[model samples]
Target: MRRRDVDTAVRHAALTFGAAIALMPLLWMVSASFMAPGEASTLPLRALPRRPTLEHYATLFTRLDLARHFLNSVVVTLAATLGSLLVTSLAGYGFAKLRFRGRDAMFRALALALVVPGQVGMLPLFLLLRELGLVNSYLGAMLPFFGSVYAIFLIRQYALSVPDDLLDAARIDGAGELRIFATIVLPLIKPILVTLAAYTFMAAWNDFLWPLIILSDSAKYTLPVALASLVGEHVQDTELMMAGAVVTVLPALGVFLAIQRHYVRGIMAGSVKG
Candidate 1:
């Protein structure tokens, strides 16, 4: 074979192998979720369930209190994502557009602070939440994300593209800063807002560590924490664990797939501007 042709064939084989390896775990998880309790672990470990059953799902809803955890995940994710978007967008726009002393230096400091690990502040954050009486509450789960340095940076980057002429016109019309931000800047940055919202939703929804730490009660467990607890208690039940994984993963996957176009666009825009 010609050298170029040989290289193309080898690359094709590599791609096919990599794709199969990546998909194998997901396939196994789905198959096991449908299997009867012990069927997933039988001698040969079948790739497909011998007999599919929804019994595990039924058990999850009826006996395992999965519904409550699902609700908690939803409420915390929505509140955090929305609240972060509003706060970050406003701050970002102000930093990008409004003139102020030490603005650039302060934003740079916040950007630098993003490099610090979240775990470094975990102990202090927990103590603060406790003092505020937010411990074990949904607000406690959502509070840490109300101010996001990365989100502010993203919004400021996007807001920099807004025309100065537009703002000047608004000011000439006697519009205040807040009014201009609400009516003009927001509509112009809708795509980035959607992108940021999707990011916050996915992050908050899949978060395991903070929720696990703050929420001591079973009633307030998010899906990931609840699934971990369930796995501990039901380790032998492979099918049940697989079902829980599916439930935990599906929402984030669905939301990503739905808004993926805008998400990709936002990333591209940020990269080019940077």
Candidate 2:
């Protein structure tokens, strides 16, 4: 083979190998979820189940009432994603386009918050939520996501790339600020918003800490917390645990896959705009 062709072949082989390695655990988890109880822990590790069954998944939905927990996760994740997108996008646009006293200073202070560990503020946040009677509520669970500095920063950076002349033209044509934002700015920044939605969805879906801390009611428990309880109660049920793992991972994976093209484009565009 020619040298360039040989190099291309080697690169593709390496990427394929890396992809397989990365996907192995997920593939195995799906495989094991279909295996009967105790089959996953057999003497010889099997890549595929000898006899695939949905009994574990059935148990998760029926006896364990994981359906409730699954619903809780869905509600919390969707609310958090939508709320975060709206708040962050508006704040970002304001920061990028609107002029006000101490605007730069305020943004700098907000940006400084990104350096602080999220764990550091959970105590005070919980206290505030308690005062507001929001503890153990879905709204409380979602409130924290609406104020993300990183999301605001990303949206602001992307919004900065909006043409000043376009905005000026809109103002001259008798368009109000809200009208221009809804009709012009939003369409221009759609890629970044889709990217943010995907990110917020994944983060909120997989989040265990804040929900666990804020929500005390067992009925209100998110999937991760419910899965943790399952681990404690059914440590020996490997197949069942794998089944729960699949449930926990599948939605986030699906959302990412669905929006992957927009996600990539948004990231590239945001990077260039910033």
Candidate 3:
């Protein structure tokens, strides 16, 4: 091959190797999840199951009650995602479209909030949740995600590009702010909403630390926390842990893959407007 052709071929080969290396752990997790209880940890370290079985999954659902944990994850993730969308979109649109004194200053202050670690507020947050009787509740798990500065920034940048004339025309026709938001602003911002939804959903789904702190009841534990529980309980069961990891990760992975095109477009669109 010519030097140019050789370089191109080498780059493709390097990329393929990098892809395989990145995917190896996930591949092993799936493979190990299918192996019999003791097979994956055996001498020689089998990469694939000799006889794949569903018993690990069966055990997780039936005996361990991971179904409940899965449901908890779904509930918290959906609630957080929808709540984040509603709140962040409204805040973003308002900040972008509406005029008020010190609005820019107020937004800058909120942006500065991103630098503060969430753990810094844990004590007060816990105390507040206790007072509101929201501890150990799904709503408690979701409340923190109801709005986010990054989400607002993204939507604000996108909303800035929306035509002022359209909103003014709607107002001239006597449409209320809520009505315009519902009918006009939302449709114009659907791509960014989907992007935000996917992000919020995945973050909520994978969350562990906050859920562990807020939820005292075993029944309220999200999947990641539950899987951590499984680690302590089934310390020797590699297959079971892998199964739990798969269960925890699959939905978030699926959602991201489903709307990745919209997510990418919204991101690019936001970048251009920004």
How many pairs of residues collide in each model?
Answer: 0, 0, 0
lDDT by residue (26-130, candidate 1, tens digit) is 888988999999998889879888889999999999899899999999999999999999899999999999999999999988888777878799999999999
User: What are the lDDT figures for the candidates, one per model?
Assistant: 0.90, 0.91, 0.89
Ranking by TM-score: 1, 3, 2
| Top lDDT hit | 2
Candidate 3 lDDT tens digits, 1-274: 7999999999999999999999999999999999998998899988889999999999999999999998998889998988899999999999999888999999989888877878799889999999999999999999999868888988998899999999999999999999999999999998789888877777788888899999989988998898888899898999999998888777777877898887677667656744
Sort the candidates on lDDT, descending order.
2, 1, 3
- Of candidate 2, the 10-residue stretch with the lowest lDDT total is 265-274
**Residue 44 Cα positional deviation in candidate 2, in Å, after optimal superposition:** 2.2
TM-score against truth, every candidate: 0.95, 0.92, 0.94
Which lDDT value does model 3 have at 203? 77
Better lDDT candidate (2, 3): 2
Weakest lDDT window of 10 consecutive positions for candidate 1: 265-274
